[model samples]
Target: MAVKVAIFDWDGTLVDSVEHIADSLHQAATELGYPALERAAYRNIIGLGIEEALESLYPGITRADMQAMREGYGRYFFTKATTPREVFAGVTEMLADLRGAGLGRAVATGKSRRGLDKALVSSGLGVHFDITRCADETRSKPDPAMLGEILRFYRIEPDEAVMIGDTIYDMEMAQRIGMPAIGVEWGVHDQDTLAAFGPKAIVDSMADLRRALELL
Candidate 1:
């Protein structure tokens, strides 16, 4: 099917928030008396839900600790962290091009609903998307549930939409549901790692991504 909608991943895909996320995770861990992990370890979990990411980083953590960590991460990320988290370069123009082409735009992200909402406002990109799904509202990445919800909302088939993200989890979920995927190289995962999931194309910049979508 020809593409009717473009579903995007938020953190590393559209916004350059990976480092800020890692720093916030580190602060949260430290606040909870958890051992510090390298930044790369935190980056690797960027595409998963906060709870899932926390679990992976600190395995065997108690439920109470998980709750505390989640709260701390949110506090640090939203209020305390000083790192700038802006939309990727040319992303606004790329989104405008997609809109002009009559394609519906949406976000399928690992961020919580609260986080995504705040980001949409702060980034001034909220007006571009017609719909959005958050990990807290649905299943996290690597599962097709959230994608399914977006498809249902748009009333389109899996093949009628494209999933654009920077992680294997995003591609895996799209592949599982028979949706086409495009990977961005500027995110947490490298090109080879993203390619392993079989995206239609892995782009290096917003211009390249727009060209890839045009060809699709």
Candidate 2:
């Protein structure tokens, strides 16, 4: 079947916010007196929902502590972090090309609704998406719930849509539903890690991504 919609992951996929995310997570842990993890440890959890990511990072955290960490991370990410949250090079053009081709554009991200909304406005990429699903609003990545919802909303089968992201979580979620996925190299996980999930292609640049989309 021809691809009708392209579902994207935010953070490292579309925006260059990985460092900021890692730094914010570190700050959050510090604020809560949690043990600091390596940058790679924080990056590895990029595609998971905040709570899920926290649990993965800090096992045995209480519910109250989890809430505090969430809030602390939010404050640092939204206000304190100095890292620029610019959109990746060619992302705007890629999205515009998808629009030109009449392919539906959407985001399935681990970010909360509030975080995504703010990002959408700041990035000016909001209008490009036809729909978006946040982790806080639905099941996080690797679960297939968010991807399932996007497929249903578009009334398209899993094969008719493609999930493009930089993490194994995104690839795994799409894989569970038998959907085609394209992995990008600029995100949380490396090519080998993403390849383990059996994506249709692993691209290093937006131009390569466009070509991969065509071949799919």
Candidate 3:
């Protein structure tokens, strides 16, 4: 059966914004008097929402501190980041191909609407997704709310769509919803870690992902 919708996990999957994410996180940590999170620590929290990331980085941080950190990170990221984030190679082409195939493409992400919009716009891929859901509106990932919303929006069964992401949160969400998932290796999560989530397959490159999607 043909897949009707392709739901993507944004940050690491479509755009290589992990470095920006981590840099902002580090700046936030410094502002809050917490130690900066290294890339590995940042990687583990990438798929989850900002709250989860802050909680993981500062295990006992107060609510006030969390709010401060979140705001601080956004300020730094939206301002200090020099180069605009670029979409991964072949992502635009692949999305165009999927759209041409009469497939609906949506982004289900942990980023808030503003953050998601900024990333997509900066990457010049905002025109690709037909629908988008961010952490601000839905329950965070591994909860299935966003993916469920995507399925509902497209009016398609879980089997009619595939969730593609680079994190365990993405795979876990797909699994809980009984949806097939594809993991990408070039993203934040390690392939082994992503494999543990029981994705339908893991592709090493976006080109490989395009092939995996069978977009001819």
Instruction: Report the C-alpha displacement of residue 132, candidate 2, in angstroms.
Output: 0.1
Candidate 3 least-lDDT 10 residues:
80-89
lDDT of 1 at 17: 90
Residue ranges of candidate 1 with Cα displaced over 4 Å: 80-85
Candidate 2: segments with Cα more than 4 A from true spot: 80-85
Ranking by lDDT: 2, 1, 3
Model 2, range 1-216, lDDT digits (tens) per residue?
289999999999999899899999999998889988989999999989999999999999999999999999998999832222488888888899889889999999999999998888888899899999999899988899999899899999999999999999999999999999999999889999999999999999988999999998
119-214: candidate 1 lDDT, tens digit per residue: 888888999999999998999889999999999999989989999999999999999999999999899999999888899999998888988988
**What are the Cα lDDT values of the candidates?**
0.90, 0.92, 0.84
**Cα lDDT of model 2 overall?**
0.92
TM-scores of the models, in the order given: 0.96, 0.97, 0.94
Which candidate should be chosen as best, given lDDT against the real structure? 2
* Residue 158, model 1: Cα distance from true site in angstroms: 0.7
Q: For residues 77-120, could you state the per-residue lDDT of candidate 3 as single tens digits?
A: 89843223367777888889888878899999998788887777
The C-alpha local distance difference test score for the whole of candidate 1 amounts to: 0.90
lDDT of 3: 0.84
| TM-score, predicted candidate 3 vs. hidden true structure | 0.94
